[model samples]
Target: MTGLLIGAIIISFSSVMVRLANVPPDVAGFYRLFVGGLGMGLFLWRMGKLKHFTLHIWAWALLSALFFVGDFFYWHRAIGLVGPGMATMLANFQVIVLAVVSVLILRERPTAAFMLAIPMALAGLYLMVGVSWADFTPDYRVGVVYGLLTALFYALYLLSLKFSLSKAGADPLAMACAVALLTGVLLGGLSLGQGESFAIPDVRSLLALATLALICHAVGWFLITRSVQMVRTSLVGLILLLQPTLSFVWDILFFDKPVNGLEIAGVILALVGIYLGSLKGKRGK
Candidate 1:
């Protein structure tokens, strides 16, 4: 649990690091995945755990990579349009998306908590974006849409990853490494096609990107992955909320994001809904 808390705090710095990098979104994502993937691969190889991957695992990893590409593409843009706090908060909407997907595709019954959470989340979004859509700038509105899309793609990525881990002899860390490498490759090609340079502009940018990859992606996730197994699912959901909550706080502290009372209330409401949505609920009455 301590590890999970620490990991969440570490990952909370992700948006700030991206802002500090001062590069194109795809470029930031590419470095994050490519550099992080290499590190994970090296570590696994050193541990003699980097065994051969089955075809099924590779296919799932590829699918997860594609979904993650979509996630980063929109999320990074949203971060640019909105501030990091709002954008990160919006992306955490994945919990709501996942609940909806479970009911619609998995034929799972929605828990009472989930049913209530949907409206709470929507209302929170309405408050966050304002009652009048026309009152906001076009960029802000577009960023909101992009943030929701991030949630969708992120949920898809999680689903694909879950399927990948369900396969026989599936190593969780190995799957993560494969997905990261594949995602990096895809993002690299996409970045080239978009004519974005891979160059790091300065020492500061390099340091920021390196920390994002090594510390946030590699170390943070390693801790969370290992610790989550020991934590209760409900508690894990609440604990992981620290990431976005602290992200919002950092946005205000570091980036000076102007927050009104309504926005603050909205964030609180949305976070509560997300936590409720994450609950799996009891089965068999």
Candidate 2:
């Protein structure tokens, strides 16, 4: 529980940091993942655990990396368009997307609680974008679409991670390193192709990027990876609710983001929706 809380808190700053880095979204993802992969590599080397992975594990981890990179790419774009707070919440709609996909592909049944949660979550998502539907301009609409794509890609990452972890018996750190390395290389190429600079803009931006790489990507996710093994998957899902919740708070506090009552209500509603949706797995257990 402590690990999850701390991890969520650390990662809640990810969007804010990316926005502050003042780089193109893809460049931000590249630097963050590349640095993180290096850090993990160093750690594993020190522990004498750094070694080649089996081809089967490498295959799954590489596939997962594509989805992971996609999530970062779309999420950063969403943050630029919709603002960090809304984008974070919107990206987190992965819970719902994952649930629906599970029902379709994995033949999982939706419980009554999950069915009840769907409308509430959707309505909350509506209220979250803006108080009135009119507030969603054509540009912001694009952001919303990006946000949904972020969720979809993240869902794919999660599912693929599950397969790699379970079927391949992949070591978590090995998988993380692989994903980070692969994603970094892929995004770095994308950034270069788009004329994004590899140079850090300034000291503060470098610090922000370093914080993202070491703290959020390495330490935060390491804790989450460890805790997930120690805790129930359903409970982990519930605890991860902190990421978006605290992200909203960070926006208001650090960025001085304005909000209306409807937005507050939407946050509450979404929280409730996520909790209800997550309950399905818990009850099944």
What lDDT does model 2 reach?
0.83
For residues 70-162, could you state the per-residue lDDT of candidate 2 as single tens digits? 999999999888778888888888888777776666777778877878888888987876456586688888998898899889888988887
TM-score of each: 0.95, 0.93
Error of 1 at 168 (Å): 5.3
Alpha carbon lDDT of each predicted model: 0.88, 0.83
**Candidate 1 least-lDDT 10 residues:** 276-285
How good is model 1 by TM-score?
0.95
Candidate 1 residue-wise lDDT, 1-285, digit = tens: 999999999999988898899999999999999898888777678778767566776787897899999998998899899878888999999999998888777777778998888999988988888665788799999999999999999999999889768863578878888898899889889899999999999999999999999998888887887789899999999999998899999999999998888888889899999999998754432
Q: Evaluate residue 246 in candidate 2 and report its C-alpha lDDT on the 0 to 100 scale.
A: 83
* Worst 10 contiguous positions by lDDT, candidate 2: 276-285
Segments of candidate 2 deviating more than 4 angstroms: 280-285
| Cα RMSD to the true fold for all candidates | 1.6, 2.1
Q: What is the lDDT of residue 48 in candidate 2?
A: 78
